[model samples]
Target: MTVPDSLADADGLATFAVATVLGFEDFGADAVVEAVRKSLPELADEYGEQVFAQLSSALRGAEGDGASPWSRRTRWPSLEDRVQRMERVEYAQLCRVRDALTLLVEASPALALARRAGVENSDVRHIEAVRALNRRTDEYLRRAEAVSRYPAERAWKGFTGLLLHVCSSPGRLSTFQQDVTVLDPALNDVPGLGRRVLARCMAASDGEA
Candidate 1:
């Protein structure tokens, strides 16, 4: 099946759920956000803009019950409404991602990949949800990395900075851990690269514990 149809495509959904979780566990939310942001380009302008708006706006909405992207999931929220709901949606989505990531870290890779596919909806472009996302993420990372003229430090920081911001949360370490595993270690600016995210998650867990 084509990329758009892959949302309902069983194989594609399965892979995405696993991979998204895998990405979260290993890479963190900023990385996941980076990955999702990277994938957003494939969403087409209107929806892409709306979705991205929701992602950012929603993250902010978490400051209050001000209706975030997920909260705005009425039959069809307007672009503005979707933007309002972004924070709630982000919270829910991030939690789901964390749960998924936590599972991958705990279980075998085969089991992680074998779970049943969730009911993933296609984005405005109508590609299978996860497939479309994964496609865009890979493309974004590649495009960002293809800066031939930029110095090595600039190029590397460009991508890593994106990962750190988008994936960061109060105390979620999984995303950070996974990201550093893949990031260039030569750069020293990011001491204990994922430390901030790790600290955030560790603090949360400690509070709960």
Candidate 2:
């Protein structure tokens, strides 16, 4: 089903490979093949486990030498090759994080808050470090604002504006540990805000409301 990366595309071969690798004895290969044919374009170059998960099926199918199309799936094991691939994946993750942080910085209250908090030299230096990673975020925001004509667009000359603000020091990170985490399930795993208590601490700084 995959656009015949090679000439010997065989029916059910891709699916059969998947089922065998999955250890499903009677899994129908034809069904899997159709699904792969429809989805391979998106999944083919996907990162990390996604690629290997799909490969598992093809790998299973290829176990027995045959004209099966699954036999044609790519294989990789060289240490140097894996290292390069890992670097690309890490690069992508970094971009996503930087973009999200930039998006946060471009918002107003966060900017005002950071500006007020970042008066000192130490704070100024920390903000600079964070900005180094946010160059792309500025670009995305510009394109977004130009198309939509939002007021925030007027504020952000570039990502550096946001980066410089966020790079300011976090105001002496507390070393004390606390059990408090998230009260809301939706916000779990979010970084930087290490604990839910930071919200309460911020509220106290602002005086009740």
Candidate 3:
């Protein structure tokens, strides 16, 4: 469904931003369904009955017998299946980014020297951006771990807090892309080294290293 223009307000915008970051793949369908339900009354009050009716109709069409609208769009039929898929995707992405960052960190000393020597390049800025993203990700992971012990409602609040912390910065996402595009090929010419680094990252992620 088309997002209504009425969502331009602060609260609406924040909700849209979170939903955009969460996407259909990254988070569970239950969260999206819950968000939609929670926002409906507020949206109706802020906008008008016509807008609310349109949104409600759209959502009704999208939803099914206790199934998320997001689930209907994808092959995964159950919340468990979707959660497993998200975990695998998140793990792989984390490993790749970690491996790339490791390489950047190893080269940081030389990059520093180059900066002192009046040698400037995009690598420095890219590295800085990626580093910021990495720091934020690490913080989010820590928060997630702490909240895992909390009850479901509190846990969800913690999750959304982490999401806001990570997704609120558009530059963080862009810089990560810049670093990956420019530095990911640094080890490509040396297949063995590339494999070794990636293997190390995977092992570390699996708690085997």
Candidate 4:
């Protein structure tokens, strides 16, 4: 399954963020917002003022009984909305947005945590560990994408089990602890990369999370 490109600069990023936040069942708006900001810094750098302003405005609107993206009666912007927004952006801006989106999607939280722990990709142990995590993550994502053709219940069970395995794998956790003082370096600073991956999965499966 092919993932659609993020092409509308801050507008596109903001839309994706809204969709993602809702996709997670709006787990915690504050937490989700911070994670979205941290994970996609390029959006901030490029259009920090407007992007954040839009995000703030959206949040303010989501308060109390106000309809939010998560509300069934108030669905998030559609593909057409995104396309229209993208069409309004300059070509250069769109290019930058595309690049930023690519980085955001490619970033791996496990790798980020490893970097924070000072584990260089140069070391064989570090390389292997990183490769292992990446390979496993990719495998699951690919399977998730392909399994869309299957019935909903079967697909959900398969993805659920896959997520549980990935989240609880002792060997994977142990590798992350190797040569690192912090057991989980990203706990304080960065958002869980796994959360981002799951968010993408949720989006692909139409908010299944």
Candidate 5:
């Protein structure tokens, strides 16, 4: 399908690329395109065109199929190389957020156990560790949000919220684990873009943990 005239600019084109990726994952392309068109004005208002361009370029590198000009892979040896060339600061911020999320996910089981045990004196060290990790995650998230001009802020908030919920409530850990498993492909596909997109979609649907 041809891109609409309204969506022909940098911001519009980036939104279109996001819709295209989401379409490939779930809804049909036509539906996604239409939905994005309807939301174009709001999205444009919410984020800067440059941020959208960076996100679109990241998505393109992630797909690596050359399906369209927007998604054509470069000769760079790695995705990180391509991202550094495009926007080094943004890439670094995203990497920090990604690493923080990964650490939180890895420590989830121990966190849950600590929460379940009621944080006795013997568990003080474990609780302190969890608090430190939580603080680090928050710091990274804030850094990412400061640099992002789009939904990354909301996505990270939702992700952190889910992580807190899972760690605090042992009963929900299994469901959280399952959801993360389902999102594993996306998480692995792109350093930060995939996680941001998936988390934003989930948050929009009120699917918290």
Candidate 6:
């Protein structure tokens, strides 16, 4: 099976959300709550409370109407709101809020897959854009030193890294793609690397060796 293309892909995100919910139904909500709490202690007085409330609600796994946890429409508004609010807050405050939110999203399938692939929370903390998720995926593989010349393994590692680097860092994408061109000719433009990588992660998470 293949992984989802991106977190923004509605179907992909939805599938991930469902998979995550089914997989981690037993997870305590306390971690989510604590992430917010630990982050808030250092926020500037003016915006700390507001950011806390927004993040808390977003991570609570329930909508205002008591529906599902991460309906794209419901979750984005809250996340977007926090993002916009952070712009007006102090730098430290913004960092804290971002950290808290990032931690919460880790419970989602998108980041969960990264974790399953062996990425730690710290690995994703520096993501500045949505594309960073893909970049981080590549980093996970690279850190594992799992890149190989075999068709399946090399295509999986190098190509996924290429896709991620291209998505997250567009300016550097050209150079990276060129580098990848020298490495794996088969993965020129499949457009399904994300899905493929995600599938690999799912398998790994299920303890498949």
Identify the leading candidate in terms of lDDT: 3
lDDT against true structure, model 1: 0.37
Off by over 4 Å in 2: 1-25, 35-42, 47-79, 85-97, 101-209
What lDDT tens digits, residue by residue, belong to model 5 across residues 87-149? 533445345444545644444433334444443332334334444544323332333333342
Tens digits of per-residue lDDT for model 1, 1-209: 22533333444345445644443334333333444554334433224345655554543443244333345431334556544544444565555544433322222222112222221211112222222445433332333334323577885565444333233422222333433223222122223323433454556668779
Whole-model lDDT, model 2: 0.39
Q: How does model 3 fare in lDDT? A: 0.44
TM-score of 1: 0.21
Scored against the true structure, residue 6 in model 1 reaches a CA lDDT of: 35
TM-score of 3: 0.24
Root-mean-square deviation of every model: 20.6, 19.3, 16.4, 18.0, 18.7, 16.5
lDDT of 6 by residue, 60-93 (tens): 5553335554442222224555445435455653
lDDT (Cα, tens digit) per residue for candidate 3, span 1-209: 33342343334445645866555334334444445544443333223345444443444545444334443332312556434434544555555554544443344344444444443344444444544555433333334445554677886676555443322333443344453554444334433443444554555558743
Worst 10 residues of 4 by lDDT: 175-184
- Between candidates 2 and 6, which one is better according to lDDT? 6
The TM-score between candidate 2 and the true structure equals 0.22
lDDT of 4 by residue, 2-78 (tens): 34223333544555567564553354445445555644543443333456556655654565444563443323445
Stretches of candidate 1 off by over 4 Å are 1-16, 19-28, 48-50, 57-209
Provide the TM-score for each candidate, comma-separated. Answer: 0.21, 0.22, 0.24, 0.24, 0.22, 0.24
Residue range with the least summed lDDT across 10 consecutive positions in model 5: 165-174
lDDT of each: 0.37, 0.39, 0.44, 0.42, 0.41, 0.39
